[model samples]
Target chain A: MKIITTVKELKEYVKNIDKSIGFVPTMGALHQGHTKLIKQAREENEIVVVSIFLNPTQFLKGEDLDKYPKKDEADKKICQLSGVDVMFFPSVDEIYTDDEVSILAPCVRGFVLEGFSRPGHFNGVLTVVMKLLNIVNPTRAYFGKKDAQQLYLIKLMARQFFMSVQIVAVDTQRESDGLALSSRNVYLSKEERQEALKIPQSLHLCAKLVSKNIRDRDEIVQKMKEILNPLELSYVEILNRNFEVIKEVELGNSVVLVEAKVGSTRLLDNIWL
Target chain B: MKIITTVKELKEYVKNIDKSIGFVPTMGALHQGHTKLIKQAREENEIVVVSIFLNPTQFLKGEDLDKYPKKDEADKKICQLSGVDVMFFPSVDEIYTDDEVSILAPCVRGFVLEGFSRPGHFNGVLTVVMKLLNIVNPTRAYFGKKDAQQLYLIKLMARQFFMSVQIVAVDTQRESDGLALSSRNVYLSKEERQEALKIPQSLHLCAKLVSKNIRDRDEIVQKMKEILNPLELSYVEILNRNFEVIKEVELGNSVVLVEAKVGSTRLLDNIWL
Candidate 1:
């Protein structure tokens, strides 16, 4: 597996290849979730290119910008084991410059859920994603649904900008006990780890309620709030594919999302109905 | 020549072409200046794609977006005469959606000169340019130095975004009397047209002064201002390629720019030293 660092070198490498490329961009903790995305990319394309960069712009001033998890050696091994053709490891300077033009997230959709909790987060994600997409010039790029809003915003960006690459949304990977896998999962204490399970449990309860013909959004949300009782809840939203809130759940077209704080760590989980 | 009205059609046409594409994006009302850019693109690449989009975002609320020149049939004829391979003409609705992601101009550089006079103008120009560039996916794009800041900002955007297309800057096309050609020139009445001559004359005088070893920026600007006296001057400053104000004119690295209002129509002219 080739390990590329600079933008110029990676671009040159992509330019010479005649085959279709599949890209999976990550911040690199080499968790099971990342491996799942890499595996899907590897299966679908002639070449799989994975990127591991802890983009600074996505984090707010007080957020975990400095302490975001990093496991570079393990991440390299994971990509090699998952059959990634190239692992692009660009420095912050390679991706960003001083006082450059920036991308702004959508006013409404980009400010809800994760965007609300962390304002300007999508801007950083989008700016970096655009840079990476242009650099890799992949045929199709894979993004896990774990960062659901990020995936939606990326799709919106692709359509809005008329980018050629297909954005493929992968299913969210989860732990056996139903905690959705996240790089920040490491930040959870033993007690917090158990509390994190409520996130998925609330989402599952929403799914179960929907299956039982409970279609009203308020009732579903009310039941969900109860399931998420005692935790510092950020939001529990029921929205359509476009992120617009719907009064009633429409199966296959609805997404029920939940976000709550587990001790000092914030966790989010959702189910597409 | 194929005329594409939809983003989907343009993307489809570009996808089938195996040859290199050269693009020139315009807002219709094609004049000698636009033709010069298109001609350069046609000569330099296997295919030439020109877009006529009157992007609304670039215009401030009270600006000439409504009254701005539109010579659609004439523009089509000019492109046909100039051997353009594809002409993309998209509607406002087709180009923009509700509360979409946007491009913000550079904090400092984007707010000076043209950006200073027309705040958020480069942001609009860049947002549309980025969209069009992605849609056409050209090999090399062409822009006239007539709109010097626009060209510079675009080159900056291409580099900053890691866009692979080469940006070829064409020389400023001018009238016999050195009045820079512009679509807005049509708005100038007969007497105003004569007054516009001083805009370029001031730039030329700066060049002549620089040639005579008039290296002081203030001295050069002062001389140019005397020549531009009595006209509503927007700005008459000199700066280097990086848009930094240099005390002394550095030949081959400096640009002398002038923006003056000939009656109500604002005209911009610049000379690369």
Candidate 2:
């Protein structure tokens, strides 16, 4: 359980190792979701690396870049208990310079749904992910399905760039009550916590409708919006797996994505049928 | 030399070999300059791979993409003669799809000099280079110093992204008459060919001034401009090795770059001190 903080050290360390490495990249505040990713990485490879850097670029000007949670000791403990070989906990300055290369998301897929409200969000995610992937050079990288759009875009980037690393998508880890686990879940007050359940509850309802062969996109969205009533809803999109808008849901190929603001914290949850 | 036309095949081929590879990426119509890069790649590593891709993204909307020169058979012969182990020649469709990930250049370093005249040019160059580098995953990649800014940006990108590939800068290959070798020299007619001599001649004068201990940037640029007179000069500037404008040339670190057009064909030449 070695903790490395600089990109150079991580690169050198990863370079010297001869085993196949599995990588899990995350922002700090390790929780059940992150534990799930690390546990899976531990199972799959001779070496497992987990990077916990709070990326600043991914946050917009008004977003909570400063208030992002940090639990370094707990994260380190999690990685150690998960059998992780190395933990990359780089500083913001170490990861980004004043002037450096950046990655841009595709216009269509990147500018819809999550991207519409939070423009340039994926660009930052992609830029940091690329930096981490290049630094680690892992054999396989684990990404949770909780950030469904981010996962899809990462997989797209890996293929489009012909990257050698295999991107593996782990299922979304959720609470027993069906609320998808997120680090920001802590931002919720007692009442807001109960309110946040509407997000996952909406998705659960959409899944039930989808299971019942309710394939119409409009009907599904309308029903989910009812479940999300009075919440500060950003969007309820029914799109194919490719992120393209479809007239109707195609079972096993469609995704019902929801983004809502519970109190001041924004949460994203989706069901990939 | 074995030629690979698809990304999948090239990845598989490069993956099976367990030797250090040196890569040189080109836009075909190989001249003495490309020959120098490939030849250097040949000497440095156990395996040498050359990619001949005329990346369309690097060309601007009104640029001569259609008129860009291509001599595939001759280029192949040159690669074979130069002892290249693998030649990757991918079609536009094979390398790119309708939707894909792209790389963006840094604002200051990317938008000056050549970048100013041709906006968004470095974006295209950086994007394609990233793709090719990922696909090949070579130990060392070769670039010429003629396109000084491009070389700098690519090196910066590799560093900023923590790319595994080592970017090695080769000196500019020149003709006996001091003209920098370029594939676009074919676009020059007999008269325009001689007119193109002014570009290198201007750089030669700039270097001669620096050798005489005359370090004033204005004086050096003025002298070069005199030699480049009546040639439809685009720009004559002096800057530090880091692309910053310098009042006085730094004895150990400076570059004098020139970009001018002859009969609507752009030519670039520079000297590094």
Candidate 3:
């Protein structure tokens, strides 16, 4: 696999190839979730390009901007093993400059759920995604549904901007114990790791309740809060695919989302109905 | 020439072609300046696309959005005569949706001259430009140096975002009497049109003084203001190409800009050193 670190070189590398490109953008410290995304991209296109950038703008001040995990050697190995054609490992200077153009997320949709806790987080996420999309000019970009809101907003951006790239959402990768895989998972201590299981357990219960047709928004939320009790819960929302609040779950169109702190690390998990 | 009105149709139309495309985005009332831009695009590319969108977002409330002159039929004829391959004319609904993604201007550069009077104006210009560029996916996008600040910001955005499209700045077009061509010139009455001559005259005087090796920014600005006297002046700034205030004008790297109201119509003019 060819590794490119500068935008000019990567753009030059991709410019001449007239084949379908599938791109997977992620922060380093690749996990099973990232592996699934890359594997799916590999299977779908003639070229699969993976970008590992720990975007600083996405992290709010006092957040884990400094301590975010980095596993460069392991990530390169993983990309090679997964059949990635190109690995883009750009430094912050290569990707961003001072007083540059930025993107603002959708006002209403962006300010809810994950957005509420981290106010301008999606701005950073969408800005970096946009820059990467332009740089790669990939035919299809793969994003896991694990970051459901981010995926949705990205798809929205592609559609609204009339971008040629097709956005594909892969199913979330999970542990045997049902905990969603996340880079932040490494930050949890042994006890916090065990407590993190409650996050998915709560989602599993919500899924079970949903399967049993007890999908009333308030009732399901109440039960979810109960399952999530004794742990600090940020929010538990039951919304439609449009990210709008609904009275009851609409099968195949609802998403139940939850966020909580395990020790000092925050984890996100959700189920697409 | 084919005229595409919807983003879907336009994207589909441009998807498979294997030729260079040159794009010119404009709000209608296509005058000599737009014709010059389109003609340059036609000469430089295999396909030339001209988009006429009177973007409302760029216009502050109570601005000239409604009164901004529309010469659609004339503009179409000009594009056809200029050898344009496609004309994209989209309505507000086709271009924008509720609370969607947006682009914010760069902090310092975006807020100086044009952005100063119309705060958040570049945001709208960039949002639409970004959308149009993505829809057209041109090889080269053309902008007139007439809108110097806009051109600079667009170039900055393309560079900052690593956009593959090459931004080509065409020379500014002017009227016989030395006034910079603009659609807003239509709002000028016969008397006001004559008064507007002082704008270019001031710039001409500044250029002549600089040619005589009088390069002090403050002295030149003061002299230009004397010539622009008794006209409601907005601002007159002489600065380096990077938009920073410079004490002395560098022969090849300075720009003298002027903005003033001619009977309540705001007009802008500039000279690139």
Candidate 4:
């Protein structure tokens, strides 16, 4: 595996290659979830490129920008083993300059649920993702649905910008016990980890309710809150693929989402029916 | 020249073409200035594509968006004669959807000169240009130096976003009388047209002063303001290639810019030393 750092070298390298490239962009702390994305990219394309840059713009002032997990050495090893053709690990300075142009999320869709809890978060995510996408110039880029809102917004951006790359949405990789995989999962203490399971459990309960023909969004959410009981729940939303709230779950077209605070750590989980 | 009206068709058309493409994006009513850009693009690349999009976002509230010039039939003829391979003309609905991601111009640099006169103008220009660039996916894109700040901001955005296209800046096309060619020149009545001569004349005087080894920026600006007297002068300033205010004119690296209103018609002119 070739490890690339600078933007110049990556551009020259991508220009010379004559193959369909698959890309997976991640904030480095490569776990099974990220590897799932990389492995899929490896299997699909002639060359797979992975970028591991912990973008700082996505974090708000009091958020965990400082405390966000890092496992650079392990990440490099995993990318090598996963058959990554090129690994772009750019520095923060390489990705951002002093107060340059930026991307702004939509006024309505970009400010709901996750966006409401963390304003301007998607803007930063979008800004960095655009930079990475332009730098990589991949044939198809993969993004895990663990960040369903992010995936949706990114797909929206790609379409809105007329970008040529295909944005492939990968399923959310999860722990066997149902907790969705996240880089922030490490921030959870032993007891907090157990409390975090309610996030996924609530989604599972919502799914079961939907399967039982209980289509009412309010009732499903009410039952979900019971499973989420004492935890500080941010929101339990049932929205269509368009991210608009629907009165009834429309099976294959609906997404049930949950976000809850387990002590100081916030956990998110969703089920796409 | 083939006319493409939809984004999907344009994408497909660009995909099938294996040759290098040069692009020139315009808000119709093509004048000598636009043709010059297209003619240069024609000479540089194997394929040449031109877009006639009157991007509404670039105009501020109460600006000339509604009253903006348009000569669609004439523009098509000009492109056909200029050897354009393809011409994309998309409607407002086809290009924009309800509430999506947007691009923002830099805070400081974007708010000076033309941006200072019309706030948020560069943001709109940058956003539309980004979309068009992505859609065209050309090897090289062309812009005239008449809208100096616009060219600078667009180049800045392409670099900041890591876009692959090479931005080739073309020199400003001018009339025999020294007036810079602009589609908006249609707004200038006979009297206003003659008054507009002061804009280029001031720049000419500034250049002559600089050529005579006069390096003081304030002194040069003072002299230019005198020549631009009696008009509603918005600004007369000098800056380096990076758009930073320089005390002394850097012979090969300075730009002298002027913006003024003649009988309610806004005109812009600049000279690169």
* Per-residue lDDT of model 1, residues A1-273, tens digit only: 999999999999999989999999998897888888888888899999999999999999988878988899999998998899999999999999987888999999999899999999999999999989999999999998877889999999999998989999999999999999998899999988987888898999998888899999999999988988889998999999999989999988988888898887888788888
Instruction: Give per-residue CA lDDT, model 1, range B1-273, as digits (tens).
Output: 999999988888888889999999999999988999998898889999999999999999899999998889999999999999899999998889997998887888899989989998998999999998998999999998888888888888899999999999999888899888999999999999988898888888887887788899999899889999889988988899988888999988988888899888998889998
Candidate 3 per-residue lDDT, tens place, B29-48, comes to: 99889888988888899999
Cα lDDT of model 2 by residue, A6-34, tens digit: 98899889878899999999998999898
Question: TM-score per model for chain B alone?
Answer: 0.98, 0.98, 0.99, 0.99
TM-score of each: 0.98, 0.98, 0.98, 0.98
lDDT of each: 0.91, 0.91, 0.92, 0.92
State how far residue A263 of model 4 sits from its true place (Å). 1.6
Residue range with the least summed lDDT across 10 consecutive positions in model 2 chain B: B230-239
- lDDT over C-alpha atoms for residue A204 of model 3: 89
True-vs-predicted CA distance for residue B179, candidate 3, Å: 0.9
lDDT string for model 2 (B166-268, tens) is 9999999998999899989899999999999999988888878888999999888888888888888767888898888999999779888999999999999
Q: List the residue pairs that clash in candidate 2.
A: none
Interface RMSD of each: 0.7, 0.8, 0.7, 0.7
Q: Give the TM-score of candidate 3.
A: 0.98
